[model samples]
Target: MQYSIGELAHRTGLTVKAVRFYSDRGLVPPSGRNAAGQRRYDDAALARLDVIRVLRDLGIDLATIRRVIEGETTVAEVAAEHVAAVEAQIGVLHRRRAVLNAVANRSQPEEASLAHQRLLLSEVERQCLIGDFLADALGDRPELAGIARTLTPELPGDPSPEQVQAWTELAALMRDTDFRANLRRLVDAHEGGLRRDLAAEVRDAVTPALVAGIGPKSPAARAIVDGLGRDPGELREWLDAVSDPRRERYLELLGVINGWAAPESMAPAFGWLAEVMAA
Candidate 1:
């Protein structure tokens, strides 16, 4: 029922060094010593070593394993805690695999990969980034308080590659103070006056022209402007205020982050309106 350190190692299929480490760590103590002063283990020691090996293979760290062996914690409790830890590690590995797959598919340059990796944020980080930005921008507006919550982006539990990329970029943009200011300005202007209704009207009127491939400077642009039932000059001014490239990019990124289908570019529509009004 007793075994030397080397014999225990061979019987348990563990390395001799590993067995010695456990012995030194007091996880598996020697019951006695042989005449040559070598360590010897009894049945209880061998049984304890077996449990340590099993727990270690289950990804339990040495500290927790020691706690379980020392009777400071139950094996079931340790197993439960370690299971949660292992599950979390698996989730991280899954996300890393997803990122690598996306990188491989795009054949992206090294710099692009580095940029994407830098921008990638965990779900909690993504939510905090967006929530902080919106809080700073629309937090004081009682009317928009609910709307801001509705507009908040939550990436799906299992996101597509495009969604992941969009989220990374969106998080970066959310952290930029200038971008936050720009969005605040847009929100403020929209809430201030008739400009609130003008955006939707413009979207409707110019969508046809953009679809028709009408150039911004074309005479046909005037017809689109006329359809909105606004003075050409007034329409042009409104377009100038709202046709920001960053705003468009924000919407594009928002669509992806929110799992919305891609929206048509409003650039062409606004372009036509601006040209016609300026003329």
Candidate 2:
């Protein structure tokens, strides 16, 4: 028995227009025309429309649905493919959620979001992300390639919770414009040879004075400063740059990312030198 479009809509819980749309798309074509030249569909059309509705609800695209209906592909094949795609999307959302959670705990949601993006990069892109960052820091010296690799964070295929947290903090730090400039200043002076071992020079001079509890403006402090041979004017900028807490934080994050030992901080030496210079 043939059913009118309205009947098909009623039977399938669809609107008449929706039924007509699928029929027009050749998904459930009219079996024949009625006496008044209206479309009429047989039981076969009704069954096909039921299948179409189920597939549509499953989020299968029209082209793929067509292939399934036409026997070009199996529903099992489509289901498997869709399951993989959906699982991939879920994985990304899970990672993003984890990053956001990390941010919520840290008070820097924006930076944590940046870390999420960094984690999404392909291996080549990941390498480039770090290469470019280090290039900006180390001036892209080929001879320093081994040094650069050592500095780069190699996030494993399946990183630990600690690594993700470390990466989130590190990525955010790396993206900060001020932090980048601070890093460049420190690196250029020391590693780039603009002023070799400037920090070391200050640390050596300042540590002895610090150990003796010498005041910044004391005569003894003055003698120590003079022995360093760096004019105070020349020393101030370097001291200020080294004194940034983020510099210390950066090293700490690097250790976490690369599985290295926690680096010894020069904060005490830098702090003492800055105080003396300010005096």
10 residues in a row with least lDDT, candidate 2? 188-197
Q: Work out the TM-score per prediction.
A: 0.67, 0.56
Model 2 TM-score, all chains together: 0.56
Q: What ranges in model 2 sit over 4 Å off?
A: 1-115, 143-147, 190-195
lDDT, residue 24, model 2: 93
Provide the overall lDDT of each model, using Cα atoms, as 2-decimal numbers.
0.75, 0.77
Off by over 4 Å in 1: 107-111, 119-128, 135-148, 156-158, 186-243, 261-279
- Give the least accurate 10-residue stretch of model 1, judged by summed lDDT: 232-241
lDDT of 1 by residue, 1-279 (tens): 889988889888899999999999888889999899988899898889889989888878888888888789988998777776677566656666666666777665984676456445565665677789898766578878776865677766556788767766776777778767766766766655646667778788778777788876777776676677765544444566568786678778889878777777778767777766777
Q: Give residue 48's lDDT in candidate 1 (0 to 100).
A: 90
Q: Candidate 2, overall lDDT?
A: 0.77
Estimate candidate 1's alpha-carbon lDDT, on a 0 to 1 scale. Answer: 0.75
Backbone clash pairs for candidate 1 read none
